[model samples]
Target: MNKQKLLIILAFFSIYFVWGSTYLFNKIAVSELPPLFLAAIRFSMAGILILVIAKLLKKSIKITRQQFLNSTIAGFLFLVYGNGVFVWALKYVDTGFAALLASTQPLFVLFLLRLIDGKKMQKKSIIGVGLGLLGMYLLVSQKTIATSEGMVLGIFMMLSCVLSWSYGSVFVSKADLPKNFLVSTGYQMFISSVLLIFCSLAFKEDISTIKTISYKVQMAVVFLILFGSIVAFTAFNYLLKVVSPEKVSTSAYVNPVVALFLGWYFLDEKLTNQSIIATFVLLTGVYFITSRKRIAKQKVRPSQKT
Candidate 1:
C-alpha cells in the first residue's frame, strides 16, 4: 500500500512540476528551431531512447495491430495537432498565458467523457467547471488576448489544441493500447514524429538550418526529450489508468502557476496582480472538484458500518 501511494505521489509530482517547466523550455527551443521541426526531432529522439531502454531491459516491445492504431490516433491528437499547434502559436503568445489557456482542458474533458463514454459527473465537478471557465475569462482579459491584433488567431488555435488534447485524453482510456507504458509511449511519440516531420517539410521549414541552432536551445531540446517526453508523459499514462481522469487532469490547475512563475523569473514575462488573483480562483475551483473525490470514502464507510 505504501509503495502504491508513493508511486502515485511521484507520478503526480512528475506531471505537476515537469510539465509546468516545459512551457519555458519549449519557448526557448522554438526560438532557434521551427515548431514542427523542434517537436519532430524531440519526439523522434525520445522515442528512440525509450525503445532502446525497453530493449536493453528485455521488455517485449511488440503490440497488437489494434494497439498500434490506437497509439497512432492518440499521437496525432495529443502531439501532432494539440502540441504542434500550441508550439506554433507560442511564436505570438506568451508561454505563461498559453498554459493558462490550456488549463481549460479539464472542463473540455468533462464533457467529452460524458459524451464519449457516458461518464457521470458530480455536483462539485459542475461547480468547479463553472469556476474554471470564469477564471479563463478573467485570465484572457488581463493579458494580450483581449487587445493584441494577432492574439485572436493564437487564442483560436489554442482552443483547438485544448479540444484536440481533451478528446485524446478521454479516448486513450478506452483504446486497446500497449500495457507496457514505456513501450506504448515510445510508439506514440514515434508515430507523431513522422507526421510532424512531414508537416515541417510541407511548411518548407529548412531542416538543415538546425545545425545553426544555439547550444542553449539544443540543451532545451535534450531536456524536453528526457524529462518532458519520457518522465512526465509516462507518469501521466500511468496515472490515467490508476486514478480518476478528473483527478489526473488537475495538473492543468497546478501547471499554470508553475509556468507563470517560471516565465516571470526566467523570461521576464509580466505577471499582473490580476493574473495572480485569477490563479487563486483557478486553483480553488480545482480544489472543489478534486477534493470532493474523498466523499466516496465517507459514503462507503457508512454502508460498511451498518
Candidate 2:
C-alpha cells in the first residue's frame, strides 16, 4: 500500500479503537474528578501539546479573525457542550449507556441536516431513524435507569450532546479554518478548554479539587489526553477532510461495543438484556443510515475550525 493508504488505515484504527475506549477512561476519571474541570485540564494540556508539535514541525499557528471566531464556535459545540458536558453527565449515567446513546448521532445528523438545509432523507435513512428511536427508548426506559437519580437528565443531556456534535460535524465540513489540520484542532481544543473552565466555575466546581484527584483517576485523565484527545480526535478531523462525514461517523458503531465491553470487564458495570438488544438495534440503524452507495466525494475543505 501507498503511504497515504497506510496513514488512512492507522487513522481509522485510532478512531475505532482509541476513541472507543475513551468512554471507559472518561467514566474512570469522572468517578473522582469534577467532569468539566477534568475536561478543561485534558483539553488544555492536549491543545498545548499539539501546538508544540506543530511548532516542531514548522506548521503555522497563525489564523485569521474569521478562523478564530469559527474555531471558538466549533470549540463550544464540539468540546464544551458535546464532550465536556457529556462527561459531566457520565457521573449519573453508565459508560456503556452513554456510548449507546451516542450511537444515535447519525440519526441526529440526518434530522439536523433536514432541518437546517432541507436535505431530503433516503428510504434507508428513514428506517434508520425509526430503529434509532426505538433503540433509544428501550435503552433509556429500563427500570434501573428510570429509578437512578439524575439518569433521565443525563440521558437527555447526552442526546443534546449528540445533537451539538452532529451539528458541529456539518458545520466543520464547510467552515474556513487554519490550513494546517493539526493547528486547527489545537485552536479548537485550546479555545474549548477556556470555555469549559468557565463552565466548571459557573457550575461551582472547585477548581482546586484537581489536587485531590486520585492517582488512578489522574492516570485515566492522562490516557484521555494523550490517546483520546490527541490521537483519536486528530484522526477524526483528518478523516473528515479525507473521506465523507458519513464514513467518519461510522465510528459511532464501533465505539459503543468497546465501551460496553470495557465497562463490563473493568468497572463491573452491568449489561442488561435490554441494553444488549438496544445496542443491536442501534448499530443496525447506524448501519442502514450509513449504507448508502458512495457518491461524488466532497472533501471537507481540508480545514475544520468548523
Candidate 3:
C-alpha cells in the first residue's frame, strides 16, 4: 500500500500497543508514586524533552494568548482531570475495569460533539454509542465494584474525568492551535505538568517515599513517559495528517482489547464471559461506525438511475 496507509497502520499499532499497555503501567506506577505527582512528573519531563527538541529544530515555540488559554484548558481537562482521576481510580479498581470505563470516552465525545456543533447524529454513531454503553454496563456488572464510600467517590471522580476528557477533545478540535502539532502538544503537557505538580504539593505527597519504591514500578513510569507520551502522541499526530481523523480515532476501539489482554497476562486479571461478549458487541459497533461512510459511498452507483 501507499506510505500514508503504512503510517496509518503504524499509528494504529502505536496507540493500540502502547496505550493499551499504559493502563497496566498506571496501575503499577500508582502503587509506588502518588497519582498526581506521577502524572506531573511524566508530563513535565516529556514536555521539557519535546520543548528542547523544538528549539533544536528552530520551530516557533511562541504561542498566542488564546492558544495558551486553550492549551491550559485542554491540559486541565484531558491531563489533570482525565488522566489524573484515572490514575487515582486505578488505586481502587483493577486494570481491566479501568480500561473499560476509560474506553467509554468515544460515546461521550459523540454526544458532546453533537451538542457543541449543533450537528445531527449519524445513524452509525448513534448505534455505536448504544453498543458502547451496553458494553460498559456488561463490563462493570461482571466486576464486584468496590462499595466502600471512598470507592464510590472514586467512581464518580473517574466518570467526571471521562466527561472532562471528552469535552476537552471537542475543544481541541475547535481551538486555534500552533502550526506544529508536536510543539503544541509539548506546551499542553508542560502546562498540565506544572498544574499537577502544584496540586501534588498541595496534597503534601512524600517525595522520600519514591526512593523506596520497586524497580519495576520505576521502569513502568519510564515506559509511560517514553512510549505513551512521546511515541504514541507523536504517532497519533502524524497519523491525523496522513489519514482521516475518523480512521485514526479507531485506536479508541482497539486500545481496550490490548489493555484487557495485557491485564490478563501481566496482572492475571480474570476475563469473564460477560467481558468477552461485551468486547464482541463493542467491536462490532465500532466497525460499523468507522465503515459507515465508505459503505454509504459504495451504495451510490453509475448504473443506478437517479
Give all TM-scores, in the order shown. 0.86, 0.91, 0.88
- What residue runs in model 1 are displaced by over 4 Å at the alpha carbon? 1-13, 235-250, 292-306
Candidates in order have lDDT scores of 0.78, 0.82, 0.74
- Cand. 2 Cα-lDDT: 0.82
**By the TM-score metric, which is better: model 1 or model 2?**
2
Model 2 lDDT per residue over 1-306, tens place: 998789889999988878788888888888788889988999999999999999999998999999999999988888899988899888888888888887787778778778987878888888988898898888888999878899999989988888888888778868998978789989999999999889998999877767888898888988999998888877877787697777776787888888899889998999999999999998898888776542123332211111
Residues 117-232, model 1: lDDT tens digits: 68677888889788887777777775455687777788788888888887887677678988777888789889999999999999999788698988999889988999988888
Instruction: Report the C-alpha displacement of residue 149, candidate 3, in angstroms.
Output: 7.9
Q: Which runs of model 3 end up more than 4 angstroms from their true locations?
A: 1-9, 146-152, 289-306
Candidate with the greatest lDDT versus the true structure: 2
On lDDT, the stronger of 1 and 3 is 1
lDDT of 1 at 136: 71
* Residue pairs whose backbone atoms clash in candidate 2: none
Model 3 C-alpha lDDT versus the unseen true structure: 0.74
Winner on lDDT (2 vs 3): 2
Considering summed lDDT, which 10 consecutive residues are worst modelled in model 3? Answer: 297-306
| Tens digit per residue, CA lDDT, model 3, 246-290 | 666566667777878888999888787877897877666655555
Better of 2 and 3 by TM-score: 2
